[model samples]
Target: MAKQEAKFDLYVFHRSYFCGKMMAYMRYKQIPCNTIYATLDKHGSDIASNTGLRQMPCVRTPEEQWLQDTTPMMDWFEERFPQAPVVPTDPVVGFLTRLLEDYADEWMWRPSIYYRWHTKEDRTLYKKLFVDELLGGFWAIGGPVSWLAGKLVHRHQEEKFLSGDGLTKANRKHVEAVYINTLDRLETIFQKQPYLLGSHPSLADFGFFGSMFWHFSNDPTSNRIMQERAPGVYEWVARLWNATSTKLGEVKFDYVVGQVPEGWEPLLRDACEAYLPYLSENAQHFEKGSKRFDWNVQGFLYPGVHVSPYRVWCRERLQGFLNALSESDQNRVREILEPMGGWKPLTSNAHIQSNWDPEGIAPLCKPQKLPLMYKLKSRFTGSNHVRTRRAWMKD
Candidate 1:
């Protein structure tokens, strides 16, 4: 039988890293797809609300089925299009690639968005005029609509920030410093080779590229810093999106970890270090059973710096996940970073019953859990509470 015809359209934001990641993948594989620009307030106008997550990077399959999130899209793509594989054939490379991709989606995205909107004064730097241009015809459908839509989104962001969930003065500094540190380290790695996994661009490269291209490259404040401090990394981001990487022989895949050029290892270590705080903070929050963060807040925050039940559970999960990996997979992770003292594995301070030691700020009393703006009325059955804030637009 013939291969099935391409199915589905993409609902995306031009500046969404998640959207960009999927788009780059679709482009690389030469998949045929329709594109829709789903701006913030216009969400109700699209099928995104019908889907569980009210988010972009959603896919509408040829069957007219809607799917959301990067991981699910990738899973669908891998099964449907197997000719040009984004996953590596080698197990070690594959595992590491998945880990890096996860890190980018979760840990990196929060701060990246913060820097895009809050870290800078200029709003035009990151807005994509092309997004409106692409949907120019839609304006006829609703001319003043886009302007109103943009205002709603801006208001939404402001309200979320003021809700006092994600961003705090300390966390902002922590995120800013780590964001720069991550780039500095990543730049060194790109300097060594074209892609993170070396010679060949893999799934991980696409994910990281999404974060870099969608946010840093588009935002004025971060973009300027990127060019000034990490020109090579910026160049690599552009290269991956190039139409040519998909075609064979334009770029060869021969880079191996040990064979990588000098100065790359240190950069990676620093990136890893920068990543730890967010990871630790999330784990702590989960354990404390605290809804300290607003679902819409753009960064990580924890009232207490010390180890909490959340951190203990998080560390346990990490250990279990690591233990489940095949020996060879574990060895590969160790080998790649052997130059940087290898994988020491993170420990839970709570489990050890040690005093809390946060990476930044002076020690303080264990803080109280912030009340959630709204709580899930029913656990796991998909129920939530509606909050009453003065500015909250009642639905």
Candidate 2:
């Protein structure tokens, strides 16, 4: 008898950015998987039961274990599959790839959310799409109630990301700047090669694909810009979406490992310039128990941005990776990043010293406190130091 093929079940939503990330990576790797759209009724309940959370784009492995978080899922699959590895083997290139991935995962999220929900056309479009996907055929027959439900769904997103400190008038320019500039830079890269690193897609490609595929390329307003301004990028997104197992294998073998592409440096520099300072300030504020943090990017002040402890953990994770390199590897990475203005933040001590829990619960940031003698000395010296700590929610 023929053996049954191994396969995994992927729970995802069409409009989810992270879901796009996972889908892109899975396609690139040619993993045999079944895609289950996580709707509001029964499939959503199943996902919640499996993961204990409502997070979309989760994978249920053949071992019966359910997993979430696109980054870690990619890592786990890379180890298991070992064919067409997304991460570079060279320490410097690997670290840079991971840094870019982190930037895309956390920083670009603001603009993705903004472009999706901040506009009437895109918001209405997404609401109807989501309603159709979530409610399935009932949406058409339900009539007025379905329309109200879709509106409620759209309003929920607007309240959570649009009306809040997420996409304010004061910071809209900065957010837009990040998206446009990133596209410009990526277009330059794609002009030279098929993928971000070379002929094959890497972690960096999948990272940006999360936002670029779902938000920038799919949203009406942003899609127009992508087609007109960066046709290369739009084409690349299509290529990634339709990649086959044979094509991935061919591209993977065609490229050499440890070789950084031509336009990667400038993109890395841009990420450093745009995201490092924001991350540093976030760490400082989260350490101080503040729910909101603010900073200036590209000479514009973004005030009252909500503090995210999860991002603080991401910063710490980047630092830990940098610190783990061998001395020679670390120096090599520094040489590449130093001129780009990324060295300091990458090497600096995290203001919020924290670690991820074993079971992946809330990451607890350790509070720093002065010794009795130091406190007494500070009192005499009139220092205004105060102690604070907070726990980050599980992503």
**How many clashes does each candidate structure show, in the order listed?**
3, 0
lDDT of 2 by residue, 1-395 (tens): 99988799988887789999999888878899998876645465455444444457878777666776788778778877888887777777888889999998887887888888888899888777777775455553467967876777666666555556646677678788888999999999888788877777888889999999988999998999999999999999998888755665644422333444578777888877878777777778777889876667777776667776667777887887888889988888788777878788666655466343333442211223334643442222111122222222333
In candidate 1, clashing pairs total 3
Instruction: Score residue 192 of candidate 2 by CA lDDT.
Output: 78
Task: Give lDDT tens digits, candidate 1, residues 171-289.
Answer: 67766765787688788778878777566677767767778887887677888889999998899888778743456444344445323324435544643454444455555555565
Q: Which ten residues in a row have the lowest lDDT in candidate 1?
A: 386-395
Residue pairs of candidate 2 with colliding backbone atoms: none
Query: How does each model score on TM-score?
Result: 0.67, 0.85
Q: Residue 214 of candidate 1: its Cα lDDT?
A: 79
**lDDT of the candidates, in the order given:** 0.55, 0.73
How high is the lDDT of residue 205 in model 1?
Answer: 76
How does candidate 1 fare on TM-score? 0.67
Once fitted onto the true fold, the runs of candidate 1 whose alpha carbons sit more than 4 angstroms away are 1-4, 40-45, 124-152, 158-166, 244-246, 249-252, 255-277, 293-324, 331-395
